[model samples]
Target: MFILKRQDVEISSIQHPKRKQNIPILTYQGQSFRLISVFSDHQQEEAKAFWRELTDHRGKACVLLEETDRFSIWGKVSLEQLRAEESSNSAVSTYTKACILVLQAVYIDVEDLLGGRQAGLFQKDITNLFEKLKFPQADSPKAVKHWLNVDPLSNSSVPAWEEHHLITLLQELYRLGKEYFGNTNFAQGVRDILQDMPANDQNQFIDWLNQSALGQLWQ
Candidate 1:
């Protein structure tokens, strides 16, 4: 069931949603597995299943966890508990690893679309993507839920992916774009979009993310 967290204090869960429940998520480059199946109860078994689904032919995976003390040596912990400890906690550390996985996937996709990896175009898109990743969000999910409750653009009608969740997605797209576009004028494209949009629209920083060069890379 793609368990995001479990721990001694409390188990915080973030299910992938009903639609994605049956989908076979690609954990890494070559290994693919169906989340519809059950995860083993034993920690070693659980770790093995996760490894088989994520590791490539060369036995490498994008996700990494160096701080092993966060859990009861079982590697079971939730995102919520991790965030509660402190600003710099194991939860953030784990999420950072997940983010890297997302980045690698998207970057490869962009490269496929653009043609071949060109240094010039890649640098521009990479720079733009990095800037968009800097937007700050509330630490608590409650704040985000409150915001989405009021705003139309933030509605749950669309599969609501947390902004923090997109870090990996954006990183992947940036990598893919570089591999495909072979170094073109990505930044200028973003600038042009900003220039054409209304001043009020300019106030919405995420609009840059929603409808510009950065957005395109994200797609």
Candidate 2:
């Protein structure tokens, strides 16, 4: 059976749904989307597994979103060219996911470094990172979660990616770390996550970071 893919989310609380509620809206790349689908929970799981197989064998575009539960939502995304070409979109999305993984890793690293202080500065830099990455209005973690249809710290899904995108993200992250918490604290955070990162590409990613415009910091 065919079913749509959706990412799971957890929320503290949500306003009760209106008897006639508007569709949940996700704004991405300057476009507004609210994908709707209906299938049994079992079928949903099967659908996700199918997507994983497709991603491993042949990349595809992000074209669906579904409501999983209260305060828990599902979403997906992909850059379908101005005219939607499968081959090119597939290649681009593959790399896009790698870049997103980099984004997720850095977010976790920096958040751990801050240790829950400086909400304003943290939000500011995160917002800047989203803007710098040119992802539209993902000016906060929540926004990022919504746009990517997954959380940064979560491992369920990834968007299109590229090596340069990873470099830009890390380089900017390094700058922000230094500017906000000093070289010592920022580098300390990098050291903390070196054992694993960017998924299995940790060593290569670290090497790329060390060679990036910012140069190696933790090492």
Q: What TM-score do all the candidates reach, one by one?
A: 0.27, 0.40
Query: What is the lDDT of every predicted structure here?
Result: 0.35, 0.43
The regions of model 2 sitting more than 4 angstroms off are: 1-117, 136-141, 145-156, 188-200
CA RMSD of each candidate after superposition: 16.1, 16.8
lDDT (tens digit, per residue) of candidate 2 on 1-219: 122324422212222132121234445444433322222333456335434433444353333334453111123332332224334444444344444554455555556666546534565666766764454345467776553335433444443333334444554555565666665454444434443335445555444445422344444
Best by TM-score: 2
Give the Cα error of residue 40 in candidate 1, in Å: 24
What's the residue-level lDDT of 121 in candidate 1? Answer: 56
> Poorest 10 consecutive residues of model 2 by lDDT?
10-19
- lDDT for each residue of candidate 1 in 1-219, tens digit (9 for 90 to 100): 232333212322343433222222323223332221122133344344434443433243223221232211122233353344354333333333333333333343445554455433543454443433322332334433332233222232322233333433443444454446465333224333334334554334335354322444432
Q: Ten residues in a row with the worst lDDT in model 1? A: 65-74
